[model samples]
Target: NAVDLGAVLEQFSLVFCRLKFIFGPMALHALDLVDLRSVLHITSPCGRSTYQVTGSSGKTYTCYKSCHYCSCPAFIFSVLRKNDSMLCKHILAVYLSQAMGACQELSVSDQQMCDILLAKDG
Candidate 1:
């Protein structure tokens, strides 16, 4: 099950199958993040949505599902600059969480959501 990630395993099997079939190794990495409950789906009062995923290093990165963009350095360096990957693990995690309904959802005020968007990750 680990190799090729073929044959659905336990828990979120459908999402795992889809990710493995559609993405590559990073999809597997995303599953690890998902298992950690790293993905958070936030909805503002006005219905605007945002996502955040914690990386292995314990840093949370913002993810934009609409653009398949992430604030993680991996996304900037590998996906945008080096053109070595399609999406970062954080972005992949978000996708996996959404597909599996595994995300930890939060409801926040529009102002809070705006602050999250503008706030520096550091």
Candidate 2:
């Protein structure tokens, strides 16, 4: 038996909406603002599949593209633990950056990551 992919996607959308409600409006709003150019992607020397994303707030979070994993709380609690395939804002931002060819890629050893972290701490 063939399954209707559209229907499946629609169901997923409903679940996403419900999850968003449970999480609160902040997450949804963040997702909406993900298209901003301020999102930065830092590449790892190990490979290009993993990145560290610096959002418009200047806070950095790690994103593993291969596993759709992010270190952000939204991804941890709302997506990973819930087994939701829908990405959080940071992940979505990275995807948007890649799709728009706007991501600034820097080598892992460039100290950009340290700079971002220190800036966040201050």
Best by lDDT: 1
- TM-scores of the candidates in the order shown: 0.80, 0.52
CA lDDT of each prediction against the hidden true structure = 0.83, 0.62
TM-score of predicted structure 2: 0.52
lDDT of 1 at 91: 85
Q: Which parts of model 2 have CA positions greater than 4 angstroms off? A: 1-35, 44-49, 83-85, 110-122
Task: Report how far residue 60 has shifted in candidate 2, in Å.
Answer: 0.8
Q: lDDT per residue, candidate 2, 14-91, as tens digits? A: 965874775455445544545445455666554443556665566677776566766777776877789654777777
Best by TM-score: 1
Against the true structure, what is every candidate's RMSD? 5.0, 8.1
